[model samples]
Target chain A: MDFALEVNKLCKAYKDTAFKLQNVSFNIPKGSIVGFVGKNGAGKSTTINAVLNILHKDSGEVAFFGKAMTDDAKYIRNDIGVVFDTVHFSGELTPKKLERVMKDIYENWDGALFLAYLERFHIPADKKIKTFSRGMTMKLSISSALSHKAKLLILDEATAGLDPVVREEILDLLLEFVENEENSILMSSHISSDLEKVADYIIFIDNGKIILSEKKDTLIYEYGIARMKQSDFDTLDKSEYLSARKRGLQLEVLIENKKQFTRAHPDIVTDNATIDEILPMLTKEESK
Target chain B: MKGLIRNDFYNVEGSMKLTMLAFIIIMIVLGIAGIYFPPNSYLASAVIGGTLGAFGALSGTAMQKDGASKWSRFELTMPISRSDVMKARYISFILYILIGLVMAIISALYFMR
Candidate 1:
């Protein structure tokens, strides 16, 4: 596969905390949007930080378009755009002044496009960023990220606090960005619905490890939640389901293949699984 | 590196202007005092030295602002190397020093006359 970004066995450890990223690895294929879903402190931000070299990794290889980050960072970084959960620019800077700062840093910065984006988002060019609300700050960050002719965009919870209307607009912009087939996005967001709207693949991380990585369509269409009695659960093999939970006399099981499960057990009912439903099922411990 | 230096300059520009304005006012007051009272001419030199010291601290303030705003982390995502970042900062510091020196020299010459 032609990948825009590749992470191999990435590891990082914090001195102050027991938290560590253990053998973390993922890939962002060209022309695709990958959703990174995990609860708080699940190493989503840590992985993104390591990938961008913001936080140094203890060991691993991060490559951008087949070029190693350590060896070709100066050249490769120009092709990547990153937006954190919070806006990183100085509060004193207006969008207009920020353009000047960015144009100098990015070789391919488009000042006209940046101004147009601000206008499109209804952001005043001359107003200081500190005065703007959280949503406006987020829009500014997205505008800056897009203005740079980047091939790969890494966004960490970029849509968390925005209203649905603005979130939809940002999702549409992301959809437009990847239309070229050469561009890709790795967005880590808590909002699974946003990911469901735009993601091609979903990678679920838990406790600093990737628990599940699969195609969004496959996850939604093939995965199923089965509610079965204790007698029926005991009759089934452990391999049949991914995880199981018990409520009263009934057992809720997460099955990997909805069609296959239904075919095998005609008497049991299996409902389609969404990312939201699957996340809790997969992350929580199975009832003994 | 040029871009990084420009950013540092922008970050400190407002405070730098205010500092320079105060620096000029102090130099002017010292210059006038030195002319009327030659015995206190040494005070002008002290003020000039003090102003330069403040300029040095102003350079550090830019870095402090960056750290406070978490801009340093964001800066790493750019193409610039770590060495380049430090070099840009030192260059900004040197520029601030040069500006202070020039103003001091002008004030010194004017007071000497």
Candidate 2:
């Protein structure tokens, strides 16, 4: 398949423990928003860092724009815009100073656009960054990232913990980026709600292993959560189930092919499960 | 590269103001308290060097802080090279150092007069 970014057989470990990212493999289609879903310490940040060459992967083949990332990481980086959850600027520097620094660094930095974003975000052009609030800091980083006209944006939990309004604004911006159909985004976020709004594809990882990767719409349609009696679940074919668990008097089952399963078993009431419900079951079943 | 350096230069917080002030005050104290002689090239050179060190330190710390910030991760994802990002902060430091030295030069000239 033609991919915008590919992580093939990627592996990494931190602090001499088990793998931080064990055999992670997935492809991000060009111009699509790929959501990276994982809990804390699930190797989401580590995966992003490896792609950016911030932390070296133990072994893997990463290709971007159909070129080997290891061989041409620097070249690939020029086209990727990265956004993280924390502020990256120094407390002392003003936006004006940061612009000057970035202009010299990025070959394609746009000073006018950066200034416009700062103004739109209501970030004071001359105020010290130390005084800026968390939301302001995030906005500042985004303004800087977008000004360079990046084709790929890698956002690591960029919207986590943000207010709904702020998160909505960011999601709109991400959607705007994807509207070009020449830009792709790989955003790693714990809040699946954020991704649900913007992601075209979803990759669910847990405890260093990737569990599921599929188009968001396909996942929503193909996989359904059914609450059935425990005895009823036993009567159904086990192969049709992605996962099943009993809680009190309720039995929840994640079906592999919800439409087909629904046709086969008309008696069962099938309902769509959110990404949050899908993740824990997928990861737990995979781990088991 | 050039843009990053420029950003660091005009930032104007501790790098430009506080550190510069501290450097100048220390230089003046050293010149007046113990070295009670008429100001000369030696005084100018010492003050400039001190001012450079002070501002240089501020910018250096700022660069490291930048590395840890959200911008660091964001910029890293872009096509720009990490080396370029790292280089921007250093160039910014050099700019701050020069700004401090300029102030020191003016102070030394005033003392000589």
Question: TM-score winner among the candidates?
Answer: 1
Candidate 1 per-residue lDDT, tens place, A199-286, comes to 9999999888999999999998899999999989998988899999887888899999998999999999889888998988888987
Whose lDDT is greatest here?
A: 1
Q: Model-by-model lDDT, in order?
A: 0.88, 0.77
Docking class of 1: medium
Candidate 2, A135-207: lDDT as tens digits: 8888888888788778788888888778888778878888988898778899998888888878899998888
lDDT of 1 at A176: 100
Candidate whose DockQ is highest: 1
TM-score of each: 0.94, 0.84
The reply for model 1, stretches above 4 Å from the true place, is A247-249, B28-39
